[model samples]
Target: MVEQADSRATSFKNILLLIADDLGKNLGCYGAEVTTPNIDKFATEGVLFSHAFTSTASCSNSRSVIYTGLHTHQSGQYGLAGKAHHFVIFDHVKTSPAFFGEQGYLTGLIGKVHVGPDYSYPWHVRNESATRDVAWVADQAGEFFDKAKAAEQPFFLTVGYIDPHRDMTRSGFGNSEIFDARIKDIPYEPSSIKVPAYINNLDESRFEFSEYYSSISRLDQGIGLILESLKARGLEDDTLVVFLSDNGPPFLNSKTTLYDPGVRLPFIVRNPKAAVKGIENPNMVSYVDIFPTFLEWTGKTQHAPTILAGQSIFPILEKSELVPESEWKHRVFGSHTFHEVTNYWPTRFLRTRRYKYHRNVAWRLDFPFSADLYGSLTWDAIRHSQPRGKEGDILVGQRKLSDYIFRPPEELYDLDEDPLELVNLAVDEKHKERLLEFRGLLEKWQDETLDPWLYRDGVSKRFIQHHLDAGMIVPDRFDLDLENIRIR
Candidate 1:
């Protein structure tokens, strides 16, 4: 018993993960007009990843990717895991908290435990409470830290802050609530904020943007309090702290879609023991990389190359430099199957440094909306706005509203020229080579990942778990003629 305890004590000890709900890269550190001083200072004290993305834009599916080191399609977390949806992670998957528990770390989750079947994420301290109340969340975290300190046991705690996500009422981002009497909410003027280019400049959008900024400030305060607690307890140097969001801001075109505004979010890491600090990493990183990175950092990973779908960034953190000739450093892939149960817009994307390609499987159907976004004041404004020149034309950003709702089967964007993904480069004759190259890359990735969504004859036959008992077989090749799918 003594030997076991000593071994555990000698291993890399503490990990603190803070996740913000429905927040994009809207911090002062990220050049946004938001008051996120605490988070910006935290980035200044550590490494800030400039191009981190999620596999999916939905809350639970994205969290599942971060926890499992697998994409949403691989993990079977198709949509939100709220009671209404009940979409859970695949039973066989091993979650991060569960894995750490086996390593003798006391795993704790403070706020929203969204992705679960309780058995999947076996957190020792599951403190699900007033997530919007930053002060309350901090108090709970302090108590957990105190407990870990008393026991002298290594700890891994995840605090999910449910801020910036729209509240029950329309246009409410939990800003009106008095979370704590001592913590006053900072007011943001609508006219002064920089509206995201994805949404039209409307009065409703400005109102919601101001509300979102207020919630972000509250989240920043929560982070500061938690960091202070760690410092006060003398665990500041030992703990490897990480801060990121589940997905993008809760709004149309940003939250539920595979656009840059949806998938590209902020990622900051602060570890005093590591050599890297206050540096910005411009490499492309996916949420899938986080799991293997954790395992590598804690010395729990096997020497053999992992099939866990993500390479660890431990080397980059240790040397304070980009990985030499790393293919993953230049590109990342994403799979988004669903948002809510009803919001089924299956799409796959391959995002490179200079380009992004998206393959929309069900391109004919009008894009469905999440319940919250559908009821939002921003959507109301867009829905009720006057139609422009044509019959189905309404201005949504730089594109026609119909174009936003009814998308093509494939989309290619030159990220350099159109950062907001305003132009479709797929049909451009000049960029055909780039489009085909990215398309081939996306297909290769799908095959490597064994993505079951590879379809033939408009059916995902490859995903069928059971084959015919006698002689039926699924073809491994993606080259299927749509005109003639022969049954031999």
Candidate 2:
């Protein structure tokens, strides 16, 4: 299924952005024991990013980063968008659809449009459904493409596949339901599937992952079907096809946490006209870079009015030579405040080539769970692994469950030494200076991003900035200590 790329064109006109829900780096291209031939073929057609990361590990928040080129803290979609969560994006935030739609491009989205206010993402065509019938989704996309062809308008279509994400039933990833005939059911043996290091390899875990693999392959079939539509329309030579996941897998350690396994998901781009094709990019690219990259692809004539925070990676994508490490940003940052309305643990992270740092604002609070993760059979495996009394010895992967829930205010891991992020170097005296360096860098980012959760003396510094302007002084600590309570 590997189609040849057209290397002659200098730029792309049509854009196809595909987002997979609750997917991690489990594809064949990423060298995992899984079935994703279509996506892997697509990777060979252009570039595969080895170290791409989402700004947040939650679905709505991560998508907001892509749509607006701003962090969740910046976009105001601090949690889930549906039901009682009811989190909506700020009206002021300029979105991708708004940018492309204004320039007379035909924009559309089919399936799983999570981030909202509805008005902010003004897609010309939208059929939001949770159906795993990817062929039906492709049919919808083809219809939009046909309309675009009829109008002779360039198209920007996003297909958000609700694949591999845990179903509301919590039993499986919609694998029991029969899908379209065009979709392939890639049934994997539970013993053959590679269990991630972050979770225990219980029989229940293996079974769930097998289901997840099938759902992922089903999602892959949709990619091929949609590409066939493009091929039929002769858009293959000039279109930019991008594929990424909203977050990590729906397992316990991956989904809601700011850990590398959570945020560092697969990001593949198949730019047909790029000078460089079939290369694995090692740069630490963030989701924020995407909006600006697409804007640049729109060309100078379109005139992007809104200034986006992410820098365009067009140079790296287009040029024959790889962008020097000095030229590219080597680190990525993440912010996670909530998953659902009830899961409010504001944490920010800075991951560099060498080390990773996490600043948990509400460290005293027990780490809350996204409902799906809580109810997952995998959680049942972990929680009931031991007898009633010995919880401390119970390990969620390598880290203890108690340590996982009750984390320190700061955590520093030399990624080279502790790639699994097991040992907390923040509590060690040897790495104090290195920890401070990363902490300062993270705080500076929080300041730059206007993050209100950047706390001092148990309160948001941005929240009390006016008070500080009035010449009030507070402790420089992240939280208040009753022992050192400030006196007015």
Candidate 3:
């Protein structure tokens, strides 16, 4: 990583990671009808990755993938980190923060530290808050930056913004609450917002989206405030800035599902060392690759865990198009187990450049909704909206309401033909070989990651492999046949 020729003298090396909660590709830079001047400015100067995807749509699991170079199923953070859910990362796994601290760097996190067992994420200065007060978060970040300068050590700070997520009460996004005066309120009207394709465009939905836009605008201001402090401290040229969202928007068909709108998110990286600037890289990358990318940036892979499941993407930091190189596979995978403790649905997926394959292990059961989505006004409108048919029907986005809840076991989508992923090509006779190839790829990934949800004869093979090894015979199939239950 060579630093390009510049007039400004670079002093310290650091990393500033900004993670926004429940934000999708609805920013002004993404060509959405939203006003985010601050974020857009950075996007103009950095590489805005158009096809970045998270390993899971659930927030905590998604964070785990970013912290450790592994998925939630392998890292042991399979669900939300709330006390009721109590999902914690495995103690044995080494997180990025821990590695940075070991290498004599000052690690700090402010606002929304969701992944825990607290010791696993041993930030040197941890000020975790859930407030949407972006200005206050910027203040804490400034103090941390000052501390790093005083200690003469490089800093690695992660600021998790709680904005843009639903207020969990209704169709609100903390707009009703008061905040620091430095946080300017950039309000939007429902008529000004354009709802995404994954959501039904209704009156209530539009109103809710307008509110979400307000929070996103506020988050952008907070980022600008923090970046200003970094520049004031003469660290702008010496730091790598990574910005992204945890998951998709908090909507019915997006949030907890394996759909593209749920996992595909806005990711931008502003590495000062890059020879080029403002490169719109089109390669598909995953959240699990984040830790490895950070490790490569800082040369901190010595103590990294041997079981890390992602490769560093730092080699192709400026490629505008997908590379034909073997190292850059142009593929990513997803793992989702739980959002809340009660919402248990294990799913895995493999996405290539043009095709996506989904394996829903719990296809027999209805997809459970997150509490926040269940109470939204958008959902209210969706349930009551009628179809113009002699036999009345309801639709969520372009998908049938029933299909959103009760899904097939195997789903394959050609994203080029169906960007919305409304068609199922898994059972199509023409794409049978394609489906089999992707299935094999996903199965190999599951085996490599040691996923417990890998199934055989309607049972988790990882849990029941002992019984089979003890001279017991079992059927070599995924689903069980009730008529042939006595097979030896």
Candidate 4:
């Protein structure tokens, strides 16, 4: 509501955050064959962050990190929401929307409101659904923009597009919904697409990828409508626009895991009256950095720098220059404790510009499968493939079934040489120093975050409890497993 003529107050009065569900950097802007022209156009007019990442690859948990500026460990949204698992954000946590509401901005969230207990993230307006009807969602967003303008209030809006996410129907992306006439059905040819190395290039994968691309094009259409809404309302010049995805595609080895295909995201930010355009930044940024950036942009940061775990990238967006070595983040971290209720495999990852390391806490156990990935067409083909000859006919996407199921305690990859992360250099004597260095960085980060997942003698301290002298329930948020039980 601050209508001063000061440049800061004038330039960034509103915020529009557009989040796509289960999407990765597979857009035409990112050199992928998928048609995301609207988002690609936004990237061309905005600052495209080449190395943005999510702290977790699961849906609700990643969005929680973005909204709360906290890792899953800190926010307590350990997995998906609204289930028996009920991994809601911590009670004391202040979400991004709630903070903006405090600063007199009308906060509105349309489409996939995946994370909650209503009290935790109190968005002023909530229109939640699983519909891939992007146009309908855009219409709702346009209405929100109009309302905010009428009230003469600054607004923060998040439109979560449910496109490109797997449909409930098998081998579908919801592209055939006749009710969604606003989205034209654009079918992709299976043979024309370039399959990423992380996924198999089988007929089933190709078919499903076609559906995925079709859904992505629909999501792009929604982006265009929302941008039009902003411009029509005359808020385009005053709104700080950000577009990203909650996680990766709903395929095996991408959505549930912390691999590049899973965690690396497409982040485009079009700051109002920015100094640069179409600049690709290579700085290491994570979803946790988002909350702080919004706070800084709106001049609503009340907490000390120590409280927020992320550093604001407003300077980067404003200048588009390489941040000084001291100010730059050389590595980003991720934690994936769960995807669905049953997928309880805990893993932590640290990725530098050159190398990536993953520490699988439950390495002895086979990685549990998420329900969607287990039932995917891609997985079906990989699971049922037969070895024809002595060479084994290039096992499922060139990865052995055993390797996919079983994991070593530590994994290190030189991403420059192995972008696909097919090679594990953890045990290689030649890369031992690099592995140890990355591992040390990861452990240090864990300690700084006070992550209960920190292991001592191979057991996660997350299960252990302390301060028991007070009462029966000892009250610790980090005890996610509820292993600390005092006999009643």
lDDT of 2 by residue, 416-443 (tens): 9888898899999998999889999999
Q: Work out candidate 1's RMSD over C-alphas.
A: 3.5
What are the lDDT figures for the candidates, one per model?
A: 0.84, 0.86, 0.88, 0.82
lDDT of 3 by residue, 322-344 (tens): 88857687789989999999999
Error of 4 at 425 (Å): 1.3
Worst 10 residues of 1 by lDDT: 318-327
Candidates 3 and 4 compared by lDDT, better number:
3
lDDT of 4 by residue, 1-488 (tens): 34443334344478899999899898989889887888888988988988899999999999899888999988888999966767888788888888788788899999888898788777889888877778888889989987887666789999888887888776888877864566677789998877878778888898999989998998898899889878886778888899999998888768888988899999999987787788888777898999888888778777423466788888666445567768777788989898787789889999888888999888878987887788888887776874432556435455666777898989998889989777999989998888878878887888788787887544454454342234334332223344654433
**Which TM-score value belongs to model 2?**
0.95
Error of 2 at 177 (Å): 1.1
Model 3's TM-score against the true structure? 0.96
In order of lDDT, best first, we have 3, 2, 1, 4
Candidate with maximal TM-score: 3
Looking at candidate 2, the ten consecutive residues that score lowest on lDDT are: 1-10
Q: Cα RMSD (Å) per model?
A: 3.5, 3.7, 3.1, 5.3
Ranking by TM-score: 3, 2, 1, 4
List TM-scores for all candidates, in order.
0.92, 0.95, 0.96, 0.91
The model with the greater lDDT, 1 or 2, is 2
